[model samples]
Target: MQSNHTEKMSSLGLSAWYGEKQALVNVSISMKANSVTAIIGPSGCGKSTYIRCLNRMHELVPKATVTGQVLLDKEDIYGPGVDPVMIRRRVGMVFQKPNPFPTMSIYDNVAAGLKLTGMRRGKSLDDIVKSSLEQAGLWDEVKYDLKKPGTSVSGGQQQRLCIARAIALQPEVILMDEPCSALDPVATAKIEGLMASLKEKYTVVVVTHNMQQASRVADFTAFLYLGKLIEYDETTKIFENPKEDLTERYITGKFG
Candidate 1:
């Protein structure tokens, strides 16, 4: 579905392509402003690819290419003079696994994104670092040891640190690719709660292998199969009364 560019944070259309092989096929969806949208599907279904395409990341691969428009606030991200770095700054990403900068302290890790955008040496930087960590819900745990290496934190803390890093730049949209897949149950729960709170301020697009996680945190859910979006609807409707039989079967623990 083509999005109303005027008000949408992100939108995609008939967007598909490949290295001489088509992966996504005319997939279209509009991400709402300041809401959580979860993409769920079996492996190799192009869930990850779809997210990457949002910031013009798919073309980063040597042999990959895509056609169709992906807009951010009505401006085509691929338009001439649009820098990928600038696009990414507006659209932050958190990977499946926690990836903290090993050499940096927790404070520095959170401030890393700001440094990339050229914010350095001031109260502004310090305030952003602290506030970002607080927003990620990690400040209470690590505030005392801001100097500690990020790798010294536990798995869950490390993930939150990564989130803090993303938020420091104040991106309008945050893309999370299976962010909780690496954490234990308790850690996963914390991240889900964080997601819930984050939507109040930032638009979040998440990809998840865990169906329950999708059900728990998503305001909207989109199901994909073979790179095609099969169903996109309110999370409750999609979970409780999916329009597509494939979605129902998958949610019921049948073959993914």
Candidate 2:
């Protein structure tokens, strides 16, 4: 069962649609502050869509739209005059692929978000980029090569570079969609460790197919199936003793 801790983020009657096709039902689950919430299930289960909604990313799709309330500390993100760009500043996202700007240097990749948000050249920008890279566990490897093209880094380092780019803005929440899926085991391990450290400062919502990664990094786990939330509970309970059959079956290798 989920904890009784006051819901840090509340969702009420949330749903989404792509054109006329419904992608998610009336799903609602609250996440605690400064904790990692893992969304896991089979492919096409709407787990990625769900996390994208948290940061208003679903709206980026041409035919996609969402209904119902998603509250960040009880403030509706969909409310009037709320700039999606500004909201994204507060709620950052890392994609499944490491999509660093190919032509940009490592330093520039990390500085991209800050620059878009009106941060200018100076000591402050430098400090923020350096600190974010360090926080993402990429500084030691790339600090000497900051001027190199971002694409020149290995797949793993590039992924961490993307993470550093996300953190450079110092977002309050970080949404990751299968961040480690393309990485090797060692690289995936580094990102997992980064997620654990990140929760100490920011609320983290991750969508992953890897059940073990969820169990290791998440404080809470929400299982979704066929556009519906089947169960949400503490990580330990969900893996050790899930309340729902679907959750158990998926976790036990019955099927994705």
Candidate 3:
């Protein structure tokens, strides 16, 4: 079924390579505004590479090259004269592991990006930090402990802190690459719970190996294999009645 929502981001014939090896092959998919889209595939299927390409992060690696276009709201992000740093600001990323800046406090970690961009210490910055933490669903837990080291938090809280850091930037799109992989079930559930509220403000794309996680959080799901997009559809349809044989096989545990 066709979706009525506006397309917030999309890739047109996007392909990527690392030195001599190609990691992605002509992958094209659209992510809708204010929704969560999940990229699911086995290891080595280029799920991470694909989302990395969305925000131009893939090119940060040496010898990494890309072809085609990544569009955010119909503008090609790879267009000449476009600043990649700005693209990254507009499309934030969260990694598999919680990686709060070790030397900074939780408050400082969330404020780091803003400060680097020349936002000075002030009430506005303070409000942004508190609001971001609240948006990440972490304000009450650590409101009184903001002075503590960012790395001092539990793995789960640290991840949420990282999310708050990303949220502080007010990005238009948020990309999570296996964000819950390192967390315990309780922590994973909390992160998963945050997804619904997050989509109300930022477009979210998550790369997850856990099919259950994808099924639980995503509005749309894309199944990839061998660096190719096999199917992209609504989450329910993808899980309950996928179109491609490869997708069916993988979803059914026949093979990855």
Candidate 4:
């Protein structure tokens, strides 16, 4: 069961399609403000597509289309007259791979986001970049090396750098799609640690295949299967005592 805390975002009858194939169906769940919500299930269960819809990124695909309501602060993001770019600004994303601008320097990579959003180069920009890097726990390691290429860092550092770029936007919500899928245990741990700290200011929704990671970081967990929501409850309840048989089976390694 979910508490009565404020919801930062919620979906109503949300569904998505790629050409003729339906990807999701009537999926509705509330993401609480300043909290971590983990979406877990087997591969191809619409985890990525569902989060993308939250930020209105699903429409970026060639044949993608979505229906229903994606409310941010109760405002319909996909409704008429709403701008998708603005929606992205309010909801930043970090993908599975640490894709920092391969050619840009670390400082430039973080600054790019601010500049694109019309924030100019100055003390303010510098402070935000530094603070975001610090917030992502990458400052000490790369502060002096700001001139180096973003890709010059280790896989873990690159991922954190990407996170810094996202946090630089100061988005209200952060959406991550299997952020640690490609990282080593140490790097994964660092990112996991970062997630816990981030919810202090932003709502976080992550899709992960690693059930243990979800159990460790998420306050609430939503289990999905075959494009349907099977169970959504506090993380402990989902793991320790899930109500749905499918959720229990998947969590216990009976099947993914």
Candidate 5:
């Protein structure tokens, strides 16, 4: 879990505002390539906002503004001439809830993004969908029922399907926002397991309220409070001996 990997993405003095209210305040953190970095905090700590900024999703909201730089592979994603669409494709995201396209077939749901971008078609598209599902660890479970509506699957399967959709885009980074918050323990375990293998191919940044989940799946962990970063370090250290008093208290269940 403590391998020496190169930094894949980082935010430098990044701050965000939703209309008049600031959601993030000069927060900065780095994620290593092919590793999982977990962001843990109590509600309204800007966990979701932080990850959204990574892919420029925050700007999609009305009155949302961000200041500072988010570097992906040493280049600022918000720099001049950079397309937000391409940034999102390279840094895919999975939401807190499973949100498969309700109107599309399971296979179609995964192919939707590719088709929208006009990236692939025919047999090549088929192959990508299959490969993506396999990567998501969902191929064996739903391969035969590819034609079924996406929502036909169990919540867990649907979440994996959403992941497959993201993988289909061949992203370098995957940002998940409380991915297991709506799942049962057994289902949550499956997603947790997927995160371990996912980091082998893509940099993963997950926002979770569950400290235990962060400890179990993340190589590095960041603790945020009231939109400010409290501490960040190897997961083992964060859980066992955090450098910040607030981090220690939060992890020890004394306060958040």
Candidate 6:
């Protein structure tokens, strides 16, 4: 909103319920294309649930239901005849834990999604895999030994491998849930730096517990508390001069 950026995804009065219990309130946020938007909030505030709804991952849970609409490129993802598999391919996800297929090699780990999407194996797949690893900043480290187990690499490299796997799909958007929470500071920094470059072409939405991380890499940040969206604005404004008292208090470390 600050820079006249085009919106890539948006939610209109979105709410979620797991069986009888509600997890997210009516949440609406327009995410900028080719920009990083960080979702920050305390635990149990529905940070994870909100992003899960983006690609319809939330519905995978039993008795899950959603109200309102999630739009990707102005198309309602939850509308009738919409394919969840197609939406997943268009909007990828990287979990908090680096979940490279343990049984697969580095090459296969990146190739798994492609194969599932009916991408025939050939030079095109090979080229895309190579390009994706390069984009994720992990090719150089593992290029020589792509045959090695994906988890054989260090924690950070494994995380980058997962990022590469997501990138291989050439998704327009990538949702990361605390992607660096398991890594040390050095590894965390690498992931953070990667996100900065990633926003050049992919609309990224990350849910992070580290407030400093949200402040550092996000173009815009949304603060949710107890399932309610307290404030949404440019990162600088949210951190420096939030309009809401709740936002100010949270940013100041008074309460989170």
lDDT of each: 0.87, 0.90, 0.94, 0.93, 0.95, 0.93
89-159, model 3: which lDDT tens digit per residue? 89999999999999999999999889887744456988999999999999999999999999999999999
Give a tens-digit lDDT track for model 6, residues 38-108: 99988988999999999999999999999999999999999999999999999999999999999999999
Name the 10 consecutive residues with the lowest summed lDDT in model 4: 114-123
TM-score, cand. 6 vs. native: 0.96
- Candidate 4 Cα lDDT to native: 0.93
Candidate 4 at residue 185, lDDT? Answer: 100
RMSD in angstroms, all models? 3.1, 2.8, 2.3, 2.3, 1.8, 2.0
Model 3, runs deviating above 4 Å: 1-4, 119-123
The estimated TM-scores of all candidates read 0.93, 0.95, 0.97, 0.96, 0.97, 0.96
Instruction: State model 1's lDDT.
Output: 0.87
Model 4, TM vs. native: 0.96
What TM-score does candidate 5 get on C-alpha atoms?
0.97
Residue 106 lDDT in candidate 5: 96
What digit string (tens of lDDT, one per residue) describes model 2 on residues 119-155? 5546688898899999999999988999999999999
lDDT of 6 at 132: 92
Most accurate candidate by lDDT: 5
**What stretches of model 1 exceed 4 Å from their correct place?**
1-7, 120-123
List model 1 lDDT by residue over 1-256, tens digit each: 3231224555566465677777788788888876789999999889998998887777888888887778888888878898988899889899998999999999989988877679554568888888899999999999999999999999999999999999998888999999999999999999999999998888899999898999999988999889899999989999999999999998998873
RMSD of 4: 2.3
Give the poorly placed runs of model 5, Cα more than 4 Å off. 1-3, 121-123
Model 3, CA-based lDDT: 0.94
